[model samples]
Target chain A: MNEADILAVIRDELARLAPEIAFETLDPALDLREQVDLDSMDFLNLLTALHQRLGVDIPDADAAKLASLASLVAYLARKGAAPPP
Target chain B: MPSLGADMEAGALVEWLVKPGQAVKRGDIVAVVETQKGAIEIEIFEAGTVERLLAEPGATVPVGAPLAMIRTEGEPAQAQAIPPPVDRPPPAAPTLAPAAPPSVTHPSPAGRVRISPAARRLAAERGLDLAALTGTGPGGAIQLADLPAAPPAAPAAAPFDFSQMRAAIAAAMSRSKHEIPHYYLSDTVEITAARDWLAAANAERPPETRLLMGALFVKATALAARAYPEFNGFFENGAFRPSAAVHVGMAIALRGGGLAAPAIHDTADLSLETLMAQMRDLVGRVRAGRFRSSEIADPTLTVSSLGDRGVEALFGVIYPPQVAIVGFGKVVERPWVVDGAIGPRPVVGLTLAADHRVSDGHRGALFLAEVGRRLQTPESL
Candidate 1:
C-alpha cells in the first residue's frame, strides 16, 4: 500500500533468498543483484516472493521496470496491494 | 575402460550395464565403475555383440582391463556362453550398491585395483600418472610403500592434502599449465539482447521450465566452435584433431568440493529450450554424483562459467586434451557505451584459454569475437 510497506515486503523476500545478505545495511539505491549473492535463480525466487507477499505479479517484460529497490517498492505501491505488518 | 579423473588409478566395476548376448554399439555404456568422483557409466568403443562379460561387477580392475568380450562385425560369438580361461577368474559379482556406494580407493583385490587412499593421494600429489605407474600394493596394487614418501614435509609445498580429488585437480591443472602453451583472450560481450530474449521466452514457460544463462553460453560456444575448428578439438601427439559434432563440456562445481566438466552431447543441434533442459539435467546429475564416462571423456570443448559470481573476467586453463575452454563471468548491468551513447546494458565478460600449440592468439581472439557476435543475436543461438 505504501512505500515503507512495499520496501518491507521486497526486503523480506530478498533476505529469504540470500540469507548471507545483511538487509539492515543494504543500500537501496544500488543494484540489488550486485549488492547481494543473488543469481538468476535467486532473482526468479525474489520475484515469486514479491508476488506472494505483496500480490504484485511482475510480468517478465516488466523485469527492467523493477530492477532496483526503489523501483520494486514503487512498482508494488502502484499495484495498490497493502502488505501485512 | 575409463579414466574417471587424473588420480583414478583404476575403477571398481560396480555393475554391468550390458550383459552377454546384448547387441552393443559405439558409445553404449557397457558397465558402471566406482571411481574417486563416484560411479561413471563406462562406454563401449566399438559396435559388436557382447559375447561375454569378462570382469564381474565387484572387481576393481586396472584402467585398461578388458571388461567384456565383444564380437565385432566379422567375428562370431561362441556357441557356448562360457568364457575362455582368463588370468584371473571374474571376482565375486556384487549387486549395485546405490544405497551405500563404496569409494574406489579401497577397491577389491580380486582382479581389481587395491590401492590405499593414502597411496593414491600421495601418488597424485607427486604427479605420477597412476595409469603409467605399476602398482606394488596388495596383489600388485600401488601403495604408499611403492611411492617414495614426501620429502619430510617440504618447506613451502607442505600441507595436509584436502582430498584425493584436490590432488587430482592440482596434478591435471599443473600439467595443463606446464605442458600446454595456453594463449588467453577476453572480450566483454553485450548480453542485453540475450537476457531480454531469454526473459521474453521464459515469460510463457512455467517457472520450473525457465532457461538459465548456462544454456545460452553453451549454445553460443557451440556455434562459435563450429566456425573455428582449432578451438573445438583435441590437441595431442603434436597434432590437432577436430571433432565434427559439438559436445560442449560444462564445468559445474560440485556442492561439496571438486569440479566435473561433463559433455552435453550434440549441443549445436538442440534448440535454446532443449539446451536449457539439458543444462539443468546435467547440473543436477553432476551434483548428485552421477556422470557418464563418455560424457566426461568426450568434451571437444569446455565452457567454465562462474555464473553470477565474483570478478568481471576469468582467464582459465584449457583442460588437457581439449584445445580450448570458454569462460563466462557474471552478467550484470553496467554503463556500456553504445553508438556514441552511454547507457546501462547487460554485459558479460567472455574469456577463452586456448592451446597455443594448436592455435595462435589471432584465431583465438576471432573465436571469442564470433561467440560474442552470436550472443548478440540470441535468437540465432
Candidate 2:
C-alpha cells in the first residue's frame, strides 16, 4: 500500500521474470530491460504480474514510461494502486 | 529416452513422476530428464500401464535407451519379457558386463535373423545395418553399440552451463550448415493493421488475457506453413517429409544464457488467445527448466524473433531435421509507399532460412508473402 510495498512487489515480479538479476545491485534509474535483459514477452509478463498483484492497469502506451524501477514505483503510486489500509 | 533435440546425445533421468503399475495415458508427463538445455519433462505417448522403470534417477541414459517399460492396452501381462538394457553403459566407458548373458542370436524357422526387441527398436529408429553388426551377446544378436557409438554421457544436472549449451548448439548448427543446403530470404511487412487490431483487442481485455504481437506472428507463420508444406516438415533419410500439422517452434532466449525454441503444437488451429496463453506458459516453463519432451522434439519449423532484442532482422540457421526457420525483427516505423504515396508505416522484418533441398526460392517467397498477407488482416489470424 506504501511506496516501499509497491517497490517490493515490483522487485519480486522482476525477480520472478529474471531470477539471475540481483535487485540490490541494480540502479533504479537505469533501464530495467538493459539491466536484466528482458525481452518483450518478459516485459509483458512483468506488467501482467504487477497488475495482478497490485490491481493496477498498465496500458500499452505507458509501458515506455515505466522503464526503470523508480518510474514503475512512481507510476503505481500515481495510479492509486494501494491496497486499502 | 526421447531425443530432446538434434544436439542431445544423452539425458540424465532426474526423477520419475510415474510409478510401476501406474496407468499413464497418451500425453502424460511421466518423468523429467536433464539435458544440456535443461530439465525436460518426458511425456509418454501411448496409453499403458508402467511395467517397470528401466533407468535409475541420476543416470545419464543415451538417446534411444529405454527409460521405462509400459504395457499397452490389450497386451497380455506376460506378453514380452523385459528386454535387456541395450544402450546403457557406464558413463566412463562402454563395458561388456561379464555377468550378463551374451546376446542370443537364433534364426527363426522362416530364416529371419533373431534380435533382441530393444536392439531391434533402436536399430529401426536409427536405420542401422543389422547385418553388418556381429552380435557380441550370447548368440551373436545385434546390439545398440553395433549401430553407432552414442555420444559420451553428459554429466547430470549441469545447471544451465552456458559453455556446454554453446558447444551443443555449435555442433548442431555446424551439422545443419554442413548437411542442408540453406537459402535465405527476407521481406519487410507493414503491420499497421495487426498492431492496431491487437491494441484495440487488448484494450477491451484485462492484462492477464491481453495478446502480444509475437502470437500474431506465430499464428500467421503457422497458417502460412500449413499452406506451404515445403516449409513445414523434416528432411530425414535423404528425403523431405512434410508434417500434416504445423507445430511452430517459438524461440525464447533464457536469461541465464543461450536459448530454446520449444514447439507450440497445432498452432494453426489455436485461437489467438489460446496461442498467447500457450506461448506464455511455454516460455515460463522453458525458462524454469521444466518443459515437456514433446515440446522440445516436435517442432516441424521454428520462428525466431529478435524484435524484442532491438535487431532489425536476422537470418537464423536451420535447426536440423526441421527444414526451415522464420525470423522476425523489431517492428519500427519506416517510410513506405502505399498507393504511390509514401508515409510512415509500422513494419517488421521477416526472414526465412529454408532448406534448398526441400523448396526453391520461388515457393519460399510465396510463403513469406502469404505470411505478410495474413498479418495485414489480423482478425482472420
Candidate 3:
C-alpha cells in the first residue's frame, strides 16, 4: 500500500476509535489533545492500532511524532508502508 | 532490536495457565512467559475462548510471535503467521519482579511532597536547608517555591511553548482548585527529639538505604491518621467514605514535568526499612518512566512537605475525593525561652487543606495539633 493509503487508513481508524470526538471537524493545525481531549491512554491506543495495522515499531519516545495528522502522515512516509522487519 | 531490556523481543512460552476451549474474561491471565526481565504473565484484553495453544512451554521465539489464538465469543480469530524461530534456550526468568500488567496495577499516583530538583539545586547553591519551606506540589513534593531566596536570572530570549503534558496539568489543577471546596489549617511542631533520633538512625544504615525526612514524616502521619480516621477518608456522593487501608500518598515532583502522588499502600503495615526500599524503588522507576498506568490513578489522601526547602509555611490544594492534604514547611531555629533562658530550637510549620463541607476548621486544627504533639515525642517512631 502507498503512504497516502496508509495515512488515510490511520486517520479513518482514529475517527472510528473515537466516535464521540468530532474527528471529522478537526482542524489539521490544532494539537490532537486540545481538539479531542485525547488523554495519554487514547494516544497509546492509536499507536497500538497503527502498529498492528501497519507493523510499524512506534517506540514510546517517538509518540510525540503523532501530535498532528500532517506529522503522522509525514512520519509514515519517511518510515514507509511496510514497516522495518 | 535496539534495546537490551523487555522490548517486544525474545519471548518464552512459560506455561498455559488456562486450558484450551475455556472461556476467559477480559484481563484474564491466560499464559505466563519468561522474558529477560522476569516471568511476565500474558493477559487477554478481550473476552474470548482459548481456541488453540500454538506454542509449547519452553519454546523460544521473537516477540510479535503468537503463542495462542483466542476466538472472541462470537467471532473467529484470523490466521496468525508464524515467524522463524531463534535458536536460543528458553530464556531464564530473572530474580527481579515480573512485569505487572498495566490494567491490573497502575503506577501509584500519590503526589510527592512537591520539592523539585531545580528548587533543591537552587536551595543548595544558596546554602539553604530545604527542610524549612512548605511544598505546594501534590503530597507536598518541593517545587520552585521551596527554593531558597535567589536573584532572578534574565529571561530567555525565546519563550518555550507549554508541553502537552504541562498543558494537561494546568487544566487539571485549575479544575481541581476551582471545583473543590477547600479549607485550610496550620500548626507548629517541635522536632528536637525526632532530629536527634534520626541522626542516630542514619548512622546505623547504609548510605543507599538512609531514611529521608519524608520517610519519618510518613511513619508519623500513619500513626496520627490511626488516631484521626476522619482526616484520612473522603467525602463522596453526599457521604464520608473512610478507607480501610492507611495508604499514605507522598507527592513527588518529576524532574521536568508535573507532580504525581504515588501512594504507599497500607503504610501502617510496612516497616521503616521496607517503606524506604519501596520509596527508593518508586523514585527510581518514576524517574525512569516505568510507572504502570494504574499506579498513577486513585489515592486516598496526600501529604506535601517542603521541609527541605527554606520556606516557613504554605498551603496545599486538596486533591479531589480526599478531604485533606497536609503541607510541611521547613524546620527553622526559633527563639523560645526554656527554664528562664532564651534558646534556639528547631520547629516545623504544617498546613492542612480540608474540604470544609465535610470537616470544619476546628476539626482540622485539632488534627494538626495531634500531628504536632506526635513530632515532639519522636522517640515513639
TM-score leader: 2
Which whole-number lDDT from 0 to 100 does residue B326 have in model 2? Answer: 94
Please state the error at residue B202 of candidate 3 in Å: 1.2
lDDT (Cα, tens digit) per residue for candidate 3, span B29-53: 4554543322344555567777777
Please give, for every candidate in the order listed, the TM-score of chain B alone compared with the true chain B: 0.76, 0.79, 0.58
Off by over 4 Å in 3: A1-85, B1-162
lDDT of 1 by residue, B294-337 (tens): 67767889998887667788888777777889999988889988
TM-score against native, each model: 0.67, 0.81, 0.49
Error of 2 at A10 (Å): 1.1
Off by over 4 Å in 1: A1-85, B5-8, B25-27, B45-47, B78-162
Model 3 chain B poorest ten-residue lDDT run = B153-162
What is the CAPRI rating of model 2's predicted complex?
acceptable
Window of ten residues with lowest summed lDDT in model 1 chain B: B90-99
Candidate 3 local lDDT, residue B258: 55
lDDT of 3 at B32: 49
